[model samples]
Target: MTGSRSSSRRALLGAGAVLIPVAAVAVPVVQRAAERSAFLALCAAWHEAKDTHEQFYADNVRTFEDEQRVAGEIDRLDNVALRLEREIAGAPARTCAEMHAKAKVAERMGERASEDIAHSLVADILREGPGA
Candidate 1:
């Protein structure tokens, strides 16, 4: 019985070792994909709502419509579901730089968007701090 138990324990340990590498690789890949998806969605939303956002946040303040759009934006950010403390411990500097650049472009074009949009995006990305 002792021999069988010890053998079983060894087998489980061996399996865990193999699975660890697989899981490590897989987790980052999954996280990177999810992060990309979230980023793309925000870009798309900005593209579609740029004008409306400018009018809403910077000037006219369209109350009802802007509320809906803002809610959607917040919800999209939530969907990224980034594990910030874990993710930031990994390296994401490159991706953060890229995101910052994109935000700059969007800000400069805030005739199409308001400055607030760029600010919001940068703030959210930094807060998430997930790896590229």
Candidate 2:
């Protein structure tokens, strides 16, 4: 009985050794394909949302509606989103420290863009003589 149990254990160990490499290779391929699919899905959604937003703005423009406030807000949002995209694209190439630094830069850029948009919106309101 002891000899049979030992043999069974050795067989299991041997099987694991053979399985490990197959799993190691397959896991990464599966993960990468899933990641690519997710990225494509997100890109499609982003494009659809962008198109919808643009169409609404275009219709307003056709009516000669005042869109300075809306435009400023959208510009700030778009800039922040663009910075986020840069960070996401850099993620695979970056170490943890590098990614952190890149994230800090993106945050700073987003903050500055928001501030500039606010300043522009205020200026436009003042120049346009009200409610802009």
Candidate 3:
């Protein structure tokens, strides 16, 4: 019984030794994946907002005031898009690749998913204001 207990403890310690390093490596990979996911969500929302505004203008006649309002909104959205692009450029290479790949998948999911994401993003921006 004593020998069995000692061997069990040794096995447990050996497993921990191996798992600790693996867990340490996995943490950063998980963090990077989360960061990439967030960035991709922002990209999808920005694309949706920009598309909606452009489509509105294209599909309907507009008053001068309406045109001006949309133009300003588009300008603001464009600035947001530019900022997002710059941020993505600064990310790690693997993160950037993941973001781009996920963004492509999000785009292909079409308008419904994008609209929901855009709505959430808009609410957050409104609640937190610019630079949030």
- Each prediction's TM-score against the native? 0.39, 0.49, 0.53
The TM-score leader among the candidates is 3
Comparing candidate 1 with candidate 2, which one achieves the higher lDDT?
1
| lDDT score at residue 9, model 2, on the 0-100 scale | 100
lDDT tens digits by residue: candidate 2, 1-132? 999999999999999999999999999999877765554444444445456556767765544345764777567657655655543443331123433433333354455444433443344335444342
lDDT of 1 by residue, 1-132 (tens): 999999999999999999999999999999888876665555545444544444445553358776666776544543332222123223232365546645644554546544445555556576667661
C-alpha root-mean-square deviation, candidate 1: 10.6
lDDT of 1: 0.55
Model 3 quality (TM-score): 0.53
Show where candidate 3 strays beyond 4 Å: 55-61, 68-132
What does candidate 3's lDDT look like per residue over 1-132, in tens digits?
999999999999999999999999999999877876776666566567557656766765368776776676667766765555454334332343553543453465455344443444345445445554
**lDDT for each candidate structure:** 0.55, 0.54, 0.59
Clashes of 2: 0
Report RMSD (Å) for each prediction in the order shown: 10.6, 15.0, 12.5
Rank by TM-score, descending?
Answer: 3, 2, 1
